[model samples]
Target: MADTPNSPVVDAQLRRASVQERLGALEVEQARLRQELVSLSGELRLPGLYLTLDAAGTSALLVADAVQEVVRLVELEPLPGAPPHVAGTFIYRGSPAVAVDLAVLLGVTREPALDAHLVICKGARPVAVLVDRVRDLVEAPVLVEGTPDGDVALPWDGTGLMAGLCRTPEGIRPLLRISAVLVGSEET
Candidate 1:
């Protein structure tokens, strides 16, 4: 719609109007893309951090968004009159949080050997879980009963701490539901 010889360049008002129109169009497109993301949410799998635990040669895993950091092992100052699962406490994030032994909680053993690693979980009720080994964190797919396809699924027998199992390259690893594990523990 150039009416003058320099309409495209000389008309500062027209240039501003053109830019505004394009910006508005781009904003609408952005909103549409966000809605598309929401619609396709079911198919998109979130990255999950899986902690592989080898408690006395038995392999297990903890799967949840609760994992904060894996710090080097340190001597735990035992909480007087605390449950056997609660090993002790230490300064985490400038505050004290209870140390939990995953093996003891799962009944694998009375206490997991404090040799190398600690999984510090962050939350309102922050606590450190003791594991024999803290394996590398991987982008775990959405955990399933068995395999992705309709096949053998590990039934929740309520004897273990995991909510379900994720079939990993190593094998099917139990996904520990941290909330459930923490619930039944004696907090007194």
Candidate 2:
């Protein structure tokens, strides 16, 4: 039997073929997008160690390259007339280094514990950041300009002090911008 173009059988067959072709195109597009994601993720990865710390209740990270050392709680000479964020000054390797209270800088009003440690960071000048505690050194991806997944909001205070957010097993940690912190401290 000769089937007309408008016949039910002919229509069904044509529709099936069209749907299959569309599916094939979609599959190819999906593969291409997957490849692009892989490439982008690799590029977004920050290559180096990061020192994670407990900033008040918030988690934060600092690039290991800028970190000089971590020292135990030391007596700091109060910088009179300095901003509250400026905890005090300390002697490091026979030179004076300003201690910036991370909690106060982040707007947290808790006093640092007696066991708190100082993360010595080298920027425009050396500064010691007072943290509640030192977490650990980790290798993680730091998104400097964009948020991960496009919809996940980071716990940032809109301060330019954070360079990015780092993804860690513990959760997302803000990456502190040492240079920005140094500049802000200088302005104070």
Judged by whole-model lDDT over C-alpha atoms, candidate 2 comes out at 0.73
Best by TM-score: 2
Task: Name the regions of candidate 2 deviating beyond 4 angstroms.
Answer: 1-43, 142-155
- State the weakest 10-residue window (summed lDDT) of model 2: 26-35
Q: Candidate 1 residues 52-78, lDDT tens each? A: 765545556665467888887778898
Clashing pairs in 2: none
Please provide, for model 2 over 56-107, each residue's C-alpha lDDT reduced to its tens digit, 9 standing for 90 to 100.
Answer: 6877888898888999879988988899889889899888889888888777
Q: Give lDDT: candidate 1, residue 99.
A: 75
Assess candidate 1 and give its TM-score to the true structure.
Answer: 0.61
**Per-model CA lDDT versus the true structure:** 0.61, 0.73
TM-score against truth, every candidate: 0.61, 0.69
